[model samples]
Target: RVFEAMLLVGISFSPLAGDLVTLVAPQVAKAASLVFLLGAGALFLWEINAAGRWVWPTTIGLGLDIVVGTMALLATAGMDGGIASLLLINLAAGGVLLSLPKAFFFAGIAVGLQYLEHLLSLAWFGTAERSLSEVSLFAVGYLAVTGLSQLLRQEVSQRQQLVEQRESDVESLSQLNDLIIRRMKSGVLVIDAQGRIQRINEAAWSLLGNPSPTRKDLTEISPELWRRMQQWRSSGRGDYTPTALVERGTEVVPRFVAVPQSPHHSAIVFLEDSSLLTRQAEQLTLSSLGRLSASIAHEVRNPLAAISHAAQLLAESDSVAAADLRLLEIIRGQCLRMNAIVENILQLSRREQSKPELVNLRRWVVEFVDEFRTVQPLGGDELRALAPETAINVVFDADQLQQVVWNLAKNALRYGRLPEAPARISVVARRLPETGQAVLEVLDRGPGIAEKLRPHVFDPFFTTNEFGTGLGLYIARQLCEANQATLELVSVAGGGACFRIAFNAQPETLRGDKLPEP
Candidate 1:
């Protein structure tokens, strides 16, 4: 458009261009040039918005230029020099707009018109001093332009293709990089100089506790992570100190790397889950412990059985005095406790791999509560169960799930009571709406686990009660993990302990037995 406009502007100012531009001069018909200019302007208008639709407009422009050039030549009394050069410019423009075959065809028409004008000029003016060679030179120039433009067009086309291919390759690589980053196990966050999260991967968002998607600031999601990032920036060292949203959550260890100077981002931060590494180490330790317990099982059990059996026999003899009866009772109680400890260790060693199956938790929990109430003494205590009417399917070992719930309920009944108050236990089963996971929560009206001890509550051999075996919670957690479930000590707002078992989401291709219909 600009090229055509500039050509029209130059034509308009041709009179100022003097005799060298003979299209308009002192003796020339200004009206004729005006007509030619109008025709050119009209052709330009016709070409508007047809650049992508290449064929028709270029043909129209070429034909118009040929007819108009011939008129200008004849009207200016064989002004071949000026009209010929102008004709060359028109040919070059045509060559650019049209394909080679059509362009050459138009150039031939202009050549033919040039000869026709020269013949008429000779007859009218009765012999002029112009030779055939001069007219032929203009003809040569037209063909040269058509050829040169075809070459220039081809070169420009190859370069354009190269550029487009390079752009496509760059886009593919960018998408691949994004996919890799999103799938990475370690969390990745790109931060700008203004402390904005310019880019964050799925693992990073999840590690930061899945903050609101619209929150772009780093500090808004996890302040501890932001602080650690600042500390690492100042010292320029590996800061592997773990950060967690809660005491029971997996700890994330973040590492920072300085990115090259960029307007959008200043650094790339990587978050590694230290909890996975810790769990691997813990698994090794437990495996060894399980082996050792199995090795000492026979030796330990024989002695424990003999002591417990002797205590019962001696008590039944009646030769035992009343004062010694208390001592006997203590001895028997200690023996029983020892035997219970031995039994727990054996259970840990002999623990089977989970055979996860689909179970309807709603019906299961109702039946579980009924059995629990029948077996356990519930003196002055309240035991209530709430389950959703709809079936809540979960992937778990039915036996293990029952055992875990039972232990949690027993603990709730035993210690979930305030002084001079009855214990209140509630077993609720429901499906989580957002994640489609089944949840079985056992809540009590007892003092919740202290914040300081919350982290270690699931650790083996860690307990506050003198008579309590710490293995209960630990074993329960192991069983849950074996079934691809999670057990956490949830903080209750009503001043009580609430243990939650978040079961694995229901399978899409569930094929096992469901709770035998209704």
Candidate 2:
């Protein structure tokens, strides 16, 4: 579009370079000005429609160029260098965007118009000296520009194709390597549409009784797995059945799922030993967890309450010695800790509906810290809560937020302290500048978690400390997800762990989500 505008501007201004009546015939100049106006309107239309849709506009534009070129030649008696240069620029620019055949065709039309203009000037105008040599030279110049533009276009196209091919090759190699590494524990077999194996992980090879190199096809190694794969392709159902692929070999369960977005009818077959798991069957039991809490209360909490009641009754006796009171206090403290552990276990088992409310985070954090200080016995541990003065609001369940924050603060006081040093922990509330989401962080000045242990921190029943039940961080994360928020262990600059809770708020709340009941 810019090139076209330049051509139009040059054409419109060329007559003004000298006295209009002396340099160009008045009648011819008026006709050319009308043509130039139409050309300007076409440029705007092409721009509004997007210049890439190039058929009608280019035709109208080039046709106007021919008209103006002819008018200039005849009006100036074939001595208008300025108007001829504008025509040459339009042709050269068109050649880059147009096909080779179209470029040559337009160039031919332009050259022919120039020659015809010279003849008209001599026969009708009879104004001044003119020659055919100048027209011949312009004709040669137009053809040369068309050929050069085509060469440059081809060179750019080849370079782009080469770069794209290299990227595809690199991506393919990376995917193949990642596939092998991630599937090493569980067997993976990728079979192409041609019924030949494309890849087989080490675990897959071992499950097939270490087949020879000649066993390339799926049918050659395990006919049962091959049969099941074909059944999945026909039925689109991946179910499990245990079968010994080789007689007197390991009993393996074969499941097949389609490789997504594969060009061919490729499938990935996962071979798991039957002894490993019945993972799908256990999912049903997890949803009926209200029964679990009832049973724990009956079997464990009943005895725990009796013990706690007995300790309180024993401490009330007037004859109990001062030294014996310390012993009784230890017993009472152990009972409380045990009850807290049982409560955590019960909390992890139940699910209840979440009621989200808009929370003023800055006010909530300060009030929550004050309440925590009254209940939890923090011995020589410095706990501070801070937030910005501006209120940061988020939609979350108030009780569930309390539970999640309590667990994080408890873990910080328990394990976040350095050896032979008092624990210093902070609960911070702020609104993130980039996302405008409310964030709450529990930070501690302690040895940070090891890199290798980071991935399994949220896994059920995973813990480094022998005394821990390992349900604190896991339950906290679950509660956050119920509120449409993320709980992650964000790395801090100084040597400490920062567990960040980043909330995702809506105009109201996230509905239809249920967290575990207490």
Candidate 3:
């Protein structure tokens, strides 16, 4: 539009143009041409100041161009002065700003104005018939330009919309990918070609032992792992062997893979904790064992019961020798032990869904200790209950929690008693302020567990004592987990073992009802 305005300004100032205009109307020709030039200049300045707002300027500018061009053509006696084609600018502007139908409408207006100018010139100045042919040709050119410009504008608009839609989709996909990566259990790290960390997820940051903010060098983190990564990259192999990176006694197994079709030559590294992998494997094994135990328990319990019945019948007989009776008693004991093992296995296999309720931890622990002391032949001072100052409520199944506490207390009494100290077991219940979880600790002054054996303490059927069932801690931990709690053997500051059960202190609404104090 600005270029068209500048061209018209030059044409109005030309000496040849002045002579042609003088030959036409002569009275109002120069005045109309000057007004047209000034109008075009004003339109150009309006467009320049319009900035990003093109719709209004384009619409008003097209209207002004058509009106001024018609006036100029009329002043110069129509197409005889050759200014009729200037109206095409209005058609082009309309096509770019408005719709195709509007562009054709403006073209029709321009053609009609030229025809009007032709008729006026013929009436006043009796201009030659050659101007009619020029008017017809200009109308045809106007229609063609309007049609082509509108088609091009429509195509560009469609392409722009498609590009915008694609960009929006890409942004949404990128955000979703980031969310999944952040929440993933396995740690993720994006490394650049220069071996610098471009991005690291929360899990990856934790797996890295949460190194200080200043530490960015992979070599500084783990030189052995960095060397292995470098070797794998340089080897140009399709696959790299997984390696473990140990930091501060925690092992993280890292697997690296190149980013597919990446131009930046980057790679994504996945880090998984070794302990987590072991736990998952153990869970899978337990799942299989649970399925197998159902079948095995039925088969083993029948024979074990028959043996126990036969042993009881034989014991009643007085004809047996003393040595043979002792042997039979041993057999009976073994049979009972085997039957107990089958019963425990069956119990473990038949895991019931947890039905949690809110219980006052302090009162529950005190009552449980009182009941336990009454049932067992222990001194009053041997077992004691220590409650928190304030009432702490936790969500758990009362029966399951009671069984877990009993097992833990029994283990504490058995292995926690030291020769130097008197036999004493303390069941302490308190709420941890930092984590907001209720903690129940069954502690005794026995020799603490060796650090080497702590990891396998919760394993099923693992025992250090010959007469131990070994499933007590395992069953306690399993029950705790089912109730969304944890059972761990934490080493006490003093020389003793502490079996801590941490309960999730969910609100009353989540656990149904809060039980009254016992």
RMSD of 2: 17.2
TM-score of every candidate:
0.57, 0.40, 0.73
Q: Rank the candidate models, highest lDDT first.
A: 1, 3, 2
Worst 10 residues of 2 by lDDT: 509-518
TM-score of 1: 0.57
Candidates' lDDT values, in order? Answer: 0.78, 0.77, 0.77
| Best-first order by TM-score | 3, 1, 2
Q: Candidate 3 at residue 97, lDDT? A: 76
Residue 41, model 1: Cα distance from true site in angstroms: 25
lDDT, candidate 3, at 343: 80
- Worst 10-residue lDDT window for candidate 1 reads 20-29
lDDT of 3 by residue, 218-315 (tens): 77776765676677689854233334554454576777788988877888888887788878998999889877976888898888898899999998
* Candidate 3 lDDT score relative to the true structure: 0.77
Better of 1 and 2 by lDDT: 1
> Whole-model lDDT for model 2 versus the true structure?
0.77
Give candidate 1's error at residue 8 in angstroms. Answer: 32
Roughly what TM-score does model 3 have, to 2 decimal places?
A: 0.73
Q: Which of the numbered candidates is closest to the native, going by highest TM-score?
A: 3
- In model 1, the clashing pairs are none
